[model samples]
Target: MTSFPDPVVLRRGSADPQAPLVVLLHGRGADEASIIGLVDHLPTGPSYVAVRAPIAEGGGYAWFANRGIGRPVAASLAETMAWFETWLDGEYAGRRSVVLVGFSGGAAFAGGLLLAHPGRYAGAAVLHGTLPFDAGVPVTPGRLAGVPVFVAQGDADTVIPRELLDATWAYLTTDAGSLTTTWRDAGGHGVSSGALAALGKWVGER
Candidate 1:
């Protein structure tokens, strides 16, 4: 297991011990507080726990930073994964399921972890993010089979292109044989009400 430093968690709603579990991850340069704000827009209750990445930046944190699709995954990936594993073990000890949620850089890290350890999560929602790329890392279907995934993207996203998203759709559904995906087509680089609504609906239908 990779070793991750302590993560900052932003608790909200109820502190009830038995609420459904959802782990929210912020994008690069954002803190857990900022990420937790999205919980206001999501279906909230006592069961949510928002976690900030351990990799601290000037004003926020980052799971991992890379130049683009071909760049090397930062050294922090392993440590972050370890940290997440410890958190999951402790937080979901008795829970049957968990929704792993992330945006931007956080989303990419979540995608990597879920893809590599599919059974660890009940489902994953990635907003404006993509699969990770590293020298030895390979995208395999068995890694995420049977998992339900929600991929929300804006058609106008300048950072992650539409073709890349299309390829991701193909890779998860075809190349990796594991997981079903629901995609949203909003037009921008950020999440929108429509996408959130769709995400909420998907969470329910799943």
Candidate 2:
């Protein structure tokens, strides 16, 4: 059985309770330690929090069932979303702004969190990921209405087809209109230095 602690807390960055919170979610098979390295690569102004998924995969962990080549399971997705909602409200009670950073499955979870809550996040950075298209999954217009989102995808991502990437881009950009999509010329399903550089710049500017 997969179990996440009550608080589900993991810290990086300087200890500053008043600092803006930036949550980083890692990809499949990678733990919190994987992407927490981005802390040194991000703007030093925010307090960084890297969270590991609750479920323990054979090699690493996963937010929920991948749901094959279609979409995530509605119930599982809802559970994950609710968990994040409760965590966000509880932990960031009166914080000024919250930034979300996710890669691969982490990106999916981060995107879902913003989609489910909308307008709550100050800004978001989605790396090598896409938004899921499901009937029950929330994608309210006002959710990400004016929120700045930085999306980076590799042109040759074998894991996620170009068609899926384009569809996700269209949905997010058209609906949110505040999304900035960057396409890298790299291959495979991983983050790139260029994407990291762009994310760093976007974090500083946002």
Candidate 3:
């Protein structure tokens, strides 16, 4: 088994141990601090934890090694997933609910987790990133049945390849059988106020 770095977690919201947990993952070349700010735009009931990715990259952090944008190496992804699960199971084994919110590269990581474990998480929000393809996760039809997923994509995004993005949108909406909420913005690779508003509402609903 591959060893991983110790996780760095930043917390916000309620201190109650029983509070529902929301894990926020940042894009590549970013840290926990980058996604922690998103807490201000989301609902207040859950305890939000921004988790820094374990792999160091360009002075920041990455969840896994990748050949290109949205193309994660299978071995690297599996190793990191194991490392994350070790910490996650230890911290939230009996928690009532745990949700994931990820952006860009982090979104792909979030998708990998959801696909790998199926019902492990209550819900997930994928913003501006594609799901992991051919990365050792089952992508069969209805793999995510009953999972509540929110996907927001920028129509003008150039960082990630368009084909990958479209394929992710199709799988999440059609094949995954998830209760999905989708949004398409005319902007670039970042979140917008409208998307955040929709996300806040969706988070509250789930």
Q: Is candidate 1 or candidate 2 better by lDDT?
A: 2
Error of 2 at 44 (Å): 1.0
TM-scores, all candidates, are 0.85, 0.88, 0.98
* Candidate number with greatest TM-score: 3
Number of clashes found in candidate 3 = 0
Mark the regions of model 3 whose C-alpha exceeds 4 Å error after superposition. Answer: none
lDDT of 2 by residue, 64-96 (tens): 676764256667767766776677788778877
RMSD (Cα, Å) for all candidates, in order, is: 2.7, 2.4, 0.8
Model 3 poorest ten-residue lDDT run: 89-98
Model 1, 46-120: lDDT tens digits are 367788887767688777645664232656565677678777788668776677888877777777778667876
lDDT string, candidate 3, 1-206, tens digits? 67777899999998888889999999999999999999999989889999999999999999999988899999999999899889998987788788999999999999999999978999999999999998888889999999999999998999999999999999999999999999898989999999999999988887
What number of clashing residue pairs does each candidate have, in the order they appear?
4, 1, 0
26, model 2: CA deviation in Å? Answer: 0.6
